[model samples]
Each structure stands twice: as C-alpha cells, then as structure tokens.
Target: MQFQILRDEEGTKADFLDLLENFKPALKEIRTATNQESINEFIVKQVPYTLSAGELESIWK
Candidate 1:
C-alpha cells in the first residue's frame, strides 16, 4: 500500500495531480491504527528525556 513516485522537473503539474487523483479510491481503502492502538502495539517501554542546550546544538550539526 506504499508508493514512491518520482516526479520529473519538466513534468506538468496537472498530470501529476491527475495521477494522484487516480489513487483516491485505493487511498481511502488504506487503514491506519489510531494513536492509542499504535501505542498499545509497541512492546518496548518509552522513556522521556530532556536534552541539554549543547547536546541539542551538536545534534543539529
């Protein structure tokens, strides 16, 4: 149910939109878990942590 579309720089915008429109019905058929359902499915425990300003800056770099 995943698609990776490559867009050409020279392609017309209308054509790209039309191609996407073709997938509308199929896209509607795709199902996704709700936030609570997704959290319930994860087996690992998540811990929250605070990052120091210096650590955050280095992470961006």
Candidate 2:
C-alpha cells in the first residue's frame, strides 16, 4: 500500500508527526529531507502532496 500525506508545516505539524508516530510500524517506507539527503535513499523522497492539505486547517479554528 502507498500513501501520500500532505502536512501544513505551520499549522498541522503536530498532526503530521502524530500520524507518523502512530503509523510508523505500518508505514513500510519513511522518507524525509534529512533521511534522503544524508543517506540518499529512496528513489524520490518527496512527492507533490495536496489531497489533505486543508483537512486540519480548521481543526483549531
């Protein structure tokens, strides 16, 4: 299974991190700037993400 997660760094960083933490085990692959840059792993670490960009925008509002 593949998943593309869109996170609003300024607003939903917590939500994003929570998702990663909660689903880390089920997440077969993990890629980030630090991981990719330091290790050059994964074909493409970053993919265009816009599906859930605003899913949590109004959670606090």
Candidate 3:
C-alpha cells in the first residue's frame, strides 16, 4: 500500500510529500503516474515476492 502511493501519486497529502522530500532531497514528484495493476507487475519483475498463507488470510481480517 505504501508503494502504491509512491507509484501513483494519487490522493496523497502535499505536506507529507514535502516532508519525504526534505529527508531525501533526491525524492521528486512524479508528474505522470498510474494507479494500475501495472505497478504490481513492475515490482514482481524487480523482486519476486510471494504472500505467505498467513499474509493472505490477514487481508480479509
């Protein structure tokens, strides 16, 4: 969920973005971002990840 905000830049508070940029000056706003399933695909390519059975179960809790 944290990574979703990073990828999409949607419904994010402006102050939070500024605070994040303050610590790491390299952080820049993405002008054109997508809140799509594509972000998941991009992440899987970089590092293969699998949700454990417990993790899956927790989602509906």
Candidate 4:
C-alpha cells in the first residue's frame, strides 16, 4: 500500500487507510478511533513484507 502526501499532520489522502481496511476488513474491528497506531504498524511491517518477496508486484497487476 502507498501513502500519499498528507493533507495535514493528522490527515492523509482520502483513500490511504481505506486500502488496508479493504485488504483485510478484520482490521477495522481492531481499529481505534484514530488510525495512528494501525497506520504506523502497517508501514513498519511493509519493510519486511516487501523485502522477503522475490520481486515487487502490484496486486492490481
């Protein structure tokens, strides 16, 4: 998932967080009123998740 330029310190592009929630709807169940922690953890986890893959591939492809 890609994060676009922030509209503000606490806001991002309209669909940023929605991407992950759409990928794994169960995430919404655990989501807090604010998405800060979820967003941080997702980005940090992406480093390892992407590196372990053989090649970069977009799910859309």
Which parts of model 3 are misplaced by more than 4 Å? Answer: 1-34, 51-61
Query: Model 3, range 14-41, lDDT digits (tens) per residue?
Result: 4333433443423223212352234334
Checking candidate 3 for backbone clashes, the offending pairs are none
Per-prediction backbone clash count: 0, 0, 0, 0
Instruction: Summarize candidate 2's per-residue lDDT along 1-61 as a digit string, tens digits.
Output: 1224442333344444355455444432544546434422221244232323243222212
Per-residue lDDT of candidate 1, residues 23-47 (tens digit): 5555445524453234223211221
Q: Predictions ranked by lDDT, top down?
A: 4, 3, 2, 1
User: What is each predicted model's overall lDDT from 0 to 1?
Assistant: 0.35, 0.36, 0.37, 0.40
What is the C-alpha lDDT profile of model 4 across 1-61, one tens digit per residue?
2443323334442344444455455544555635635544556454333221212112111
TM-score of each: 0.33, 0.26, 0.24, 0.25
Better of 1 and 2 by TM-score: 1
In model 3, state the lDDT of residue 14: 41
| Highest-scoring model, TM-score | 1
TM-score of 4: 0.25
Candidate 2: Cα lDDT at 26: 40
User: Which candidate leads the pack in lDDT?
Assistant: 4
